[model samples]
Structures are given as structure tokens and as C-alpha cells.
Target: MTRRDDIIAAAIRLAEQSSTGQANLSVRAVAKEAGIGASTLRHYFPTQSDLHEAIARRYMHVAINDFSIDDSARDPAERLFECCAQLLPSHEHRQIQLDTWLSAHVNGLGPERRAPVRRLLEHSHEVTYDHLDRWLQVLVDEGHLDAAEVAPSSTALFTMLDGLALHSIITPERITVDAARDQLRWLIAKVLEPKS
Candidate 1:
């Protein structure tokens, strides 16, 4: 991997660490984790904002584009559900993501702190919608989704999944992981199953 890729990977690793769960980790801590001198890290990142931006972009790319789903899994609902599930972060990742977002709000640093979180969340949202839209269209083409419900159904499903993700993350006690997954699957069934 290129030096830039190495630095970014190290940044992600540091960000995702339980210790660095919050977004305010010092650049020195990240550099230490990356096994590089702080000066070396600064040579590439120049500032914490630059590092945060790079890490956020990498997170979006991995979370949105790198995951694979089975289109020929014989169960369209399951397939589509898997596709949507890829957008949700793991427990550790979720904690880090939530901390990052929450810290941004708490600091009230305006663009300086919130920029990375805003960019990451917004890009992830758009990418999720695009994926959902395409999957809905494919479901219709495959006779799994009814043509009549294409527009409204896709939007509704996208909103549901997005809301569920946030709710599950912010209030895990209220909506347990299994409960969230079950709800998602149930919603998928409603959209994919033919009406009686």
C-alpha cells in the first residue's frame, strides 16, 4: 500500500480503537498508534482536520462501497436486507461513529469540528439512498417489488432503515440489536411480499 494508504489505515485503526472511541484523540496518539513520528504524520495530514477528513472519507468508502451482497441468494428480501445492512456499523464502529458525531455537537466548534462528521454522514446518506434505490429497482425488475410501489416504497424503506440505524445506535436499550434486525427484516418482508 502507498504511504498515504498506510497512514489512513492507521488513522482508522486508531479511531476505531476502544480508547480512541471519542473523536478528540490527539494527533500524537494516532501517530504513536501508527508507529510513525508525529512530524511524519503531520507531513501527510498537516492538521487534525485533514486527518479526520481522510478517515471519514475512508469510512464512507469502506462502509458503502466495499461490502458485497449476494444478488442470487434465492431470497430477494434477504438479499436486499443484506445489502441495506451493510450500511450499518458494527458495535465498535458504531460507538466510534456516535462519539465522533456527538463530540462535534458538544464542542460547538462550528465547521472545524463538525465538518468531518457532517461530510461523512451526508456522503453515507447519499450512498445509502443510491444503493437502496438501485436495489428497489432491481427488485421490481425481478418481480419481487411491485411496479406500482416503486417510488414511494423505495423512499419509505430508505427512511425506515436510516431511522432504525440512528435509533438503534442512540438508544440501544430501547431497541436492542436483535430487535432492530428483526424490525428491518419485517419491513423488508412487507415490501417484497406480494399483497394478498
Candidate 2:
């Protein structure tokens, strides 16, 4: 891997292992984890915002794009639901993600502390939306979804997934994985229904 890739990977590792998760991806911690001087790390990232953005982008890419679920034999609705499920926190990481979200958004931060956190959340949403958009278009190309349904369906699915994810994190007893899966599968089926 390139030095830049190494630095970003280190940042991701530190974030994952941290109490605050992604919100803890500071320049000094990442540099120390990478065993590089802070100056060298800064040379590649230039600023903390750049480093956080790179880390979030790479981490989300790996999390969503590299998910290993085998959907080849599944119907299109099932396949799409599997893809969307990757966005929700897995059992192992659910608590960590919840902690990070609470720390970054629920707990009050001064203006100086809030901007970077806000940027990271916004960038994460953008990356997630782009991936969802591409996944929906793939189904459309395969005759599973109408072209007109892509925009609204994508938005609705994203919003539902967000709420479902939060519920899974904050109240798993109420929104178990099976329940979430059923809701998502139902939504996907509705979106893919043929127009009369």
C-alpha cells in the first residue's frame, strides 16, 4: 500500500478501537498508530479534515463495497436488501457505532469541535447515498426496478434504513435484525412491483 493508504488505514484502526470510534480519529493518534512522525502524516493529509474525510471514505468503502454476502442465487429484491443491510451496524460493532453517534451528535460540542464531526457525518451520508443510488440503478438495468422509481425509492430506503439502524442500535429489542430485514425486504418488493 502507498504511504497515504497506510496512514488512512492506521486512522481507521484507531477509530475502530477507540471509545468514541470514528470521532476519535485525530491526527496525532493516527500518526502514532502508523508509527510515523506527525509531520509525515500531515504531509499526506495536510489537515485533520482531509485525514478524517479520507478515513471515512475508505472505511465506508470497505464496509459497504467489500461486504461478503453471497447473493448470486437470490432474487433481485433479496439481493438489494442484502446490499442495504451492510449499512446497518453489525452485532459486533453496534455498541461502538452507537457510542460514536451519541458522542458526535447527542452530546453537545462547541463550534470548534462540531464542524469536523458534522463534515464527517455529512460525507458519510453522501458516500452512502452514492452507493445506494448505484445499487438501485443496477437493479433497474436488470429490469427489476422502474427508472422513475429510482430517486424516490432510494431516498425512502435511505431514510428507512437510517431509522431502522438507530432503532437497532438504541432499542434492539424493539427492532431486531429480523424485523428490520423484513421491513427492508417489503420496501424493496414494493419498489420493484411492475406498474400496471
Candidate 3:
């Protein structure tokens, strides 16, 4: 990878490792992690805010790429449910990203800092909405749902998934992944099941 890519990757790793309760992030630390001199790191990222923005962008890109939509499934409902399930963060890295986002909000890095994060957040929402939209279109086309039902159904599913993700991140003990999955399954069944 190019030096810029290496530096961005290192900054993301550092951000993941260094939570809110940790020491301040430093160019020297990121440079060492990136296997480059601080001067070289500065060449690409002139300020800590620049590096932080790069990290946030990279995190968002990774999250977007993780959304695996399986269109080959015979059942449209199953495919839609699987796609929504993929939006939830894994337990291994969810807290790290959450911590990084929360840190960015309070760090007072100004527009330079907040802009990329805001873009990332918006991109994530758009990606999720796009997936839900497609699912609704498929259901409507298959005659399982009416065209008029698409928008409200898609919004409900998206909101349910977002709420589950938030609850999983904030109250893992109270709402386990299994519970979230079960809730999602029930919602999916309610929304997509035929009017038998």
C-alpha cells in the first residue's frame, strides 16, 4: 500500500485500540504503528484531525463493505432478513467503533474533524436505507406486498434494525444478540409473511 494508505490504516487501528478512557492519540504513536517516521505521517496528515478523519472514513467504508446482500436465495423474505442481519455490528469491534464515534463528537476538532464523521454517519444510513428499499421492491414485485405498502414497511424494518443495533451496543447484557436476532425474525415475519 501507499504511505498514505498505510498511515490511514494505522490510524484506524490505533483508534480502535485507543478507547475513550485512553491517553491522547499522537502522531508519534501512529507513525510507529504504521512503521514510518512522524514526519512522513505528517506529510499525509498535517494534523491530528486529518488523521482522525481518515480513520473515520476508513471505518465507514469497512462497515459499508460488510453489508452482504444475498440475492440468490429462493425465498425473498429470507434474503431480506439476512441482509438486515448483516447490518448489525459484530461484538468484537462494535464497542471500538462506538467509542471512536463518541470520542470524535466530544474532541472539539471543529469542522475539519466533524465533517468526515458526519459524512460517514450519513453514508451508513443511506446504505442501510438502500438495502431496505431493495427488499421492499422485491416484496412488492413478488406480489407478497402492495406497492403502497413499500415505504412504510421499509421504514419500519430499518427503524427496527437500527433500534436493535443501538440496544445491542448500549445494553448488551439486557439485549443479547440472540434476542436481537429473534426480534428481527419476528418483525420480518410480520412484515413479509403472506396474508394467510
Candidate 4:
């Protein structure tokens, strides 16, 4: 692996280890974890936001690859659903991730610290949007969606998926795993609907 990959791997390990999530992923800590000097890490990731973006992208890549989205034997809609479903955490992992995110980003903070936390949240949203954008682009390329619809479609789809994921985590009794999947499938159908 490249040094850059090594550093990201170290950060992922630390993130997985910490209950506080990526909020506690300080440069000094990541550098030490990677067995590299702070200066070396900076050379690869000049800023905290850059490092966070890379980490988020890596997580999404791994998550997307874990599913059989490439299996052409499955129906296209099913394949699309699987691709989008990758964005949502599985039933067993949802609560843990939600709890970690809350503890890291939202649990306790004054106005003074809100700015940095807000930046983190924005970066997280952008990463999610970016992944959705790519997935939608593929559908567009395959004539399943309009090329012009990507921006709005990605935004709307991400919003729904984000809400569905959070609700499923917070109130599984109301938004059961099957219910969330049904909602996602409905949203995908709407997105794939041809423009009038």
C-alpha cells in the first residue's frame, strides 16, 4: 500500500477503536498510529478536512464494494436498490454508528465549537452526495435516468436515504428494517420514473 493508503488505514483503525468516532481523529493521533511523523501526514493530507474527506470516501468505497451490485443476473432495479442500500448501515450496525456520530458531533458542544463541527457535518453530507451522484450518473448512462436529473435526483434521494437511515436507527419499531428497504425501493422507483 502507498503511504497515503497506510495513513488512511491507520485513521480507520483509530476511528473503529474510538467510541467518539472521527471527531477524536486528531492529526497527532493519526500520525502516531501510522507510525509516521506529523509532517509526513501533512504532506499527504494538508488539512483535517482533507483527511476526513479521504477517510469518508474510503469507507464508502468499501461499503459499496461489499454488495453484489455488479451481478447482471439480478434485475436492474434490484441492482440499483442494492447500490443505494449500501449507503445505509445494516440493522446490527445502525445504532452503533448513530451513537458514535451523536457522541462525536452532537452530544455536547457550545457555540464556540459549533463551527468546526458544522464543517465536519458539511463534509459528511458532501461525501454522501458525491457517492449518490456517481450512482445516479451510472443510471443516467444506462438510460434509466435523465442526465439532467442527476443533481436534483441525487439531492432528493440523499435526503430521503439520510432520513430513512436515521429514523430506522432511532425508532426501529416504527421504521423496521424491511420498512426502510421498502421506502428506499419506492424512492428509487420514483427516481427512475421517466420525466413527463
Candidate 5:
């Protein structure tokens, strides 16, 4: 592989394997893993933020592309649950990813590094929100949810997802992935249930 590809692969490996996530990513470390000098790696990514942006873009791309609900499933509620489940940090690896990213955002190397990390964090949340909005809209169209509930429910769902992620990261033993999924489904069911 080329030097650039090698650097990216090394970065990805660190991000995927480490609990601290991309916060643990370092030029010297990645360069060493890629069998290159630090200067050479710097040539490709002059700043830590540049490397972070690349990792964030690639990671988010894969995450979004990987989130798939089997279209063959006839039930819209099931599909919605699947969609939300896909977005949750339900697994150890996923929780690590979210924690690592959030940690970097909060404790970035410096202002220079923090800006790109901020952008990455914001972009990821927006991507998640967009996905939820689409799922909620689908349910609304099917008459399972009210049209007016879309805006409020979207915010609520996103908040719940974020809360779940935080609890998963901070107190994982307290909230298993299955429990989190069940709670998410309950929220959806409660919102969609008809009132007298």
C-alpha cells in the first residue's frame, strides 16, 4: 500500500482497537505503525486535526453505510427499531468509539486540534439526527405517529440516544446493550401509541 493508505490504515486500527478511540491517535505512533518516519507522516498530515478529520470522515462514512435495516421486514416499527438500534452504541466497540470521540472533543490536544474535532462531533450528531428524522417521518406517514410529533420526537430520540451512549460509556454494567435497546423501543412505542 501507498504511504497515505498505510497511514490511514494505522490510524483506523488504533481508532477501532483502543478504548480511548481517536484520542489515542498520534502522528509518531501511526507513522511507526506505517513503517515511516514522523516527518513523512507529517508531510501527509501536518496537524493532528487533519489526521482526525480524515479518520472521522472515514469512520462516519462506514458507520452510516453499515447501518442497514432489512427491507424485507414487513413491519415499520421493527424497521424503526432496527434503524435506532443501528445508531446506538450498543456494543463495547461502539461505546468505545463514541467515548473516544467525545473524549477527544472535550480534551483535545489544543485549540488547533479542538476545532476540527468539534466539527467532526457536530457532523456525526447531525448525521444521526438526520437518520432518526427519516425513520420518524416514515412512521408518521404510516399513521403510527402524528405528523406534528415529528419535530419534538426527533429531539427526544436524539437526546435519549445520547443519554444511553453516555451511560453506556460511564456505567456500562448498569445498562446492557439489550436493556438500552428495550428502553429505546419502549420510548418509541409510548410515543406512537394512540391516546383516548
Candidate 6:
């Protein structure tokens, strides 16, 4: 990796490790973790804000890429469930990212400082919406759902997924992946079932 990449990686690691407490990171500390000198880190990052922005951007990208929609699940419902599973992070990692993100927001160093972070948020949302749209199309094509019901169904499904993600993050012990998948399937079945 290039020096810049090394520095960014070190910053992310530092942020992840120090996210829980009052451990204020320093250039020297990050450089030590990164196996580089403090002057080298300074040459690349220049300021604490710059380092923070880099770490935040890297975190956002990692989160976005963690959800892989490329799996060969021909069934739209299965693909949706897979995507949902990706949304549920390990409890420890989720807490770290959540704490770091909240801290960044409080410190006024969130997406506002970096256009890439802002774009990542927008793109991630768009990707989710697009996946839902495709699922709706599949349902309609299979005669399981009415074509006219696409918009409302997609909106409701996305909202449900978002709610489930928040709940899972807050109560990781209670919200297992299987539970989320089962609930999602039940909701979709209810929305798509034909009138008796």
C-alpha cells in the first residue's frame, strides 16, 4: 500500500480502538500504530481534522461495501434478506462505528467536511432503494404482487428494514439475523398475498 493508504488505515484503526473512551488520538500515536514516524503522518494528514475526515470517509466506504448484493440469489426475497443480513454488524464493531460516527457528528466533522462521505450516504440509500425496486418488480412479474402497488410497497419495505436495523443495533441480543429475515418475509407475504 502507498503511504497515504497506510496512514488512512492507521487512522481508521486508531478511531476504532479509541472510539469508546476519552482516548484522544495523536499523530505520533497513529504513526506508531501505522509503523511510520510522526512527521510522515503529519506530512500526509497535516491536521487532526484532515485525519478525522479521512477516517470517516474510509469508514463509510467500508460500511457501504460490506453489503454485497452480487450474490446469485435468483429469488428477490432471498436477495433482500441477504442484504438485510449485511446491515446487521457484529455487536462490538457496530458499537464502535456508531460511537465514532456520533462523535464525528458532535465534533462537526462528519460528512460536512468531506464530499465523499456525503456522497457515500446518498449512494448507499440509492443502492438500497434500487434493490427494493427490483424486488418489487420481481414480485409483480411473478404475479405475487400488483404492479400498481410498487411504490407504496417499496417504501414500506424500506422503512421496515431501516427500523429493523436500528432495533438490531440497539438490542443486538434480541434481534438475531434469522428473526429479522423471518419478520421481513412475513411482512412481504402479507403485502403480496392475494385476497381470499
C-alpha root-mean-square deviation, each candidate? 4.9, 4.0, 5.5, 4.5, 5.2, 6.5
Q: Candidate 1: which stretches are off by over 4 Å?
A: 1-3, 13-44, 64-68, 86-113, 137-141, 146-154, 165-174
Clashes of 4: 0
Best by TM-score: 2
What digit string (tens of lDDT, one per residue) describes model 6 on residues 1-196?
9898988887777777774665456788888989999888889989876786676556655654323334434555565555545554444476665454444333444444555445545555676666667766666776667888888888887777767666666776776656766777777666666766
lDDT of 5 by residue, 1-196 (tens): 8777778888888777776523468888788877889999999999987887887766775676323333534566677777777767746576566767468657544455666767787778787777777777777766778888888888988888878877877777876788889888998787777866
Could you give the candidate ranking by lDDT, starting with the highest?
Answer: 2, 4, 5, 3, 1, 6
- The runs of at least 3 residues in candidate 6 whose Cα sits more than 4 Å from the true structure, single-residue gaps closed, are 13-25, 64-68, 88-158, 165-181, 186-196
Candidate 3's C-alpha runs over 4 A off are 1-3, 10-25, 32-36, 64-68, 71-74, 89-120, 130-154, 165-175, 194-196
Better of 2 and 4 by TM-score: 2
Query: Considering every candidate listed, which one attains the maximal lDDT?
Result: 2
Ten contiguous residues minimizing lDDT sum, candidate 1: 64-73
Judge candidate 6 at residue 42 and give its lDDT: 88
**Cα deviation of 64 in candidate 6 (Å)?**
4.5
lDDT of 1 by residue, 29-105 (tens): 87877788999999999988888778777777666642233365567877777777655545657666545545644
State each candidate's clash count: 0, 0, 0, 0, 0, 0
In angstroms, how far off is 68's CA in candidate 3?
A: 6.1
Off by over 4 Å in 4: 1-6, 13-33, 37-74, 101-113
Q: Each model's TM-score, in the order given?
A: 0.63, 0.75, 0.58, 0.69, 0.65, 0.51
Residue by residue across 65-170, what tens digits does model 4's lDDT show?
Answer: 4255445466657877887786665677767765655554562243455554566566667767777777777677677888889999888878887687668667
- For residue 15, give model 4's deviation from the true position in Å: 5.2
Per-residue accuracy of model 3 over 1-196 as CA lDDT, tens digit each: 8889988888777777876557345899999999999998889999887887677656655654323333444676676667777666556666765455455444434455656556656666676676677777776776777787788888888888767766766798876767877888888888876765
Q: Is candidate 3 or candidate 5 better by TM-score?
A: 5
Scored by lDDT, model 4 comes in at 0.76
